[model samples]
Target: MNRQDIGFVQSSINYQFKNLQLLEQAFTRKSYSEEHPEVQNNEVLEFYGDEILDFFVTKMMYKRFSRILNNELVSEKNEGELTKLKSILVSKESLARCMYNIGFSKFLYLGKSDEKNEVYKSKSVNEDLFEAIIGAVAADCDWNYENLEKVCRTMLDMETTNGYLALLVKEKSHRLGFG
Candidate 1:
């Protein structure tokens, strides 16, 4: 991606990394990294971002659902449950929607060959890019837990539900034929 594209992405996230190289790495797919052995892929950042994302989500859940008993929060304990929830919240579909809404798609750096690939246009790509961006932000800035939480909350649409209680209520009603 050009410097202008990078600037656009940075503006969208409202956080710029101290090391532009880190930001570049975050956008660099394994395919491109293979061609440039000196550069790194976003996989490691993806790993770190994955953990940070889970922590942020779990903390939000606990904070928002403070009235619920510990045992009642079934989805908090199970690995599968957390994974499922993350998939919904952090999925490519959700991330791409968020990015597109914020105008980040225009800054993406897909290889020339994959630029037109249908998969590149899929939500998975967007989600992956978002995770990579998170990794980049964490690497670039002094993103403490509080700021990270704020970012995740904004990106995941967590502000509207306060731990999804309203969603749960609606879901339960629908299950019982109330819908």
Candidate 2:
């Protein structure tokens, strides 16, 4: 991407990249790179991002639900509850929805064939691009907690996660006779 593309995306996201190439690579799909041959695709970045996201989501769940582990009350949290919440937080559907919510759909770079198409509108493609963006950010920022946390808090749909977790807590409380 040109400097203008990087500038536009960074300005929109409120985060600047130390390396614009990494950010550009994040949006590059195999089809695009296959044609260019010199440009790198986002597959490796997506893989790394997936693992990093799992760590962040898992950490968030552990911290958010720490009371369940230490509480003596019947309304305490459980492994199952935390697991369920984390699963939803890291799921492809949720990530894609969050990406679209943030208006990153227009930035995806596909090959000439799919360039005109809105195929990036697909949920799975959005999810992959989301991961690629995470990977790109991680590459630029080095996976620091502050950087990753900022990305996670900004990109993940925590409000939806909270809603589901709230429901879980309510059900548990009801079963415990507190509701």
Candidate 3:
């Protein structure tokens, strides 16, 4: 991506990149990298992002649901419950859906052949891109937790809820310092 198009990406994530190249790398896919040769693909970046997302979600869950985990609630939860919540929060589908909602699908630098590949256009690709973008943001911010957290909050659509269960959880989460 050119420096000129950085505005669209930044607008979507609500974070400006100190290193514009990192932002471009986040959107670069293997197909594009194969042809570019010199430019790095998002695989390694995605790897870092995957771990970051897992860590962030796990930390958030532990802190947000400490009452249940610590038996502070009337209906205390077991480790299994926490595991389920973490799984759901960091699931590939969840992250992919979040990214798609952010209009990231329109910005992927896929090659012509990949453009027609059904799998390449699937949620899995979005999931990979989502994580890659997270890694890019983390790198852009020099690994600052606050900066990364803001991107995660925006990219993962974690700022809002629609379902009944989510609403209930958000309501109860206030006791755990979520609000």
Candidate 4:
């Protein structure tokens, strides 16, 4: 990618990569790597990122809904509810929406076949890209919690996600006559 394209991606995600190569790899799909044997695909990064993303979102949910009282942590949400919310936050649809919001599809490095098939339009591909980027950032920053958190929050639109969760909670409370 050109410097200008890199800059656009970095600015869009609100984080700059110290290792630009990682960023490039994050956008590289398996098909592209198949064509260029020397180039690495994003599958491994995506796997690592999927785990990290899960942990990060879970942590955020815990902090938001949990409280310390009598030296014990109590969560306002039940396990099932929290799980449901986390699933929603990390859903393919949600991640795809994030990619769309940041206009990231055009930056993906796909093989000719993928490009011809318009894989960029696939929600699954978009979700994979989102996770791959997170993986790239985590690797670039050496897994620094603050840096990863910042990038995830900005890239995934945590503010909006939190707002949506709040609405859900409020609606549930109101329905239960507890609000």
Top model by lDDT, which number? 4
User: For residue 93, what is the lDDT in candidate 2?
Assistant: 76
lDDT of 4 at 145: 90
Tens-place lDDT digits, model 4, residues 1-179:
88999999998778999899999999999999999999999999999889888988899898899999999989998999798888888989888888877778898999999999999999999999999999999999999999888888887783348545676888689989996
Better of 1 and 2 by lDDT: 2
Candidate 4 residue 38 C-alpha distance from true site, Å: 1.1
Best by TM-score: 4
Q: Give candidate 1's whole-model lDDT.
A: 0.64
Report the lDDT tens digits of candidate 3 across residue range 1-179: 55556787787777998888888898888998898899898998899899888888776766666655355553344687777766766777777777666666777888767887744558899889889999998888888999888787777663223332584587589879979
Flag regions of model 2 displaced more than 4 Å.
Answer: 1-5, 11-14, 67-75, 157-179
lDDT of 4: 0.88
TM for every model, in the order presented, reads 0.71, 0.80, 0.80, 0.91
Model 2 residue pairs with clashes = 68-77
Candidate 3 segments exceeding 4 Å error:
2-5, 67-76, 118-120, 158-179
Candidate 1: C-alpha RMSD to true structure equals 4.5
- The superposed Cα distance between candidate 3 and the true structure at residue 144, in angstroms, equals 0.7
lDDT of 3 at 59: 69
Lowest lDDT sum, 10 consecutive residues, model 2, at: 67-76
Model 1 spans with C-alpha error above 4 angstroms = 2-4, 67-87, 116-118, 157-169, 172-177
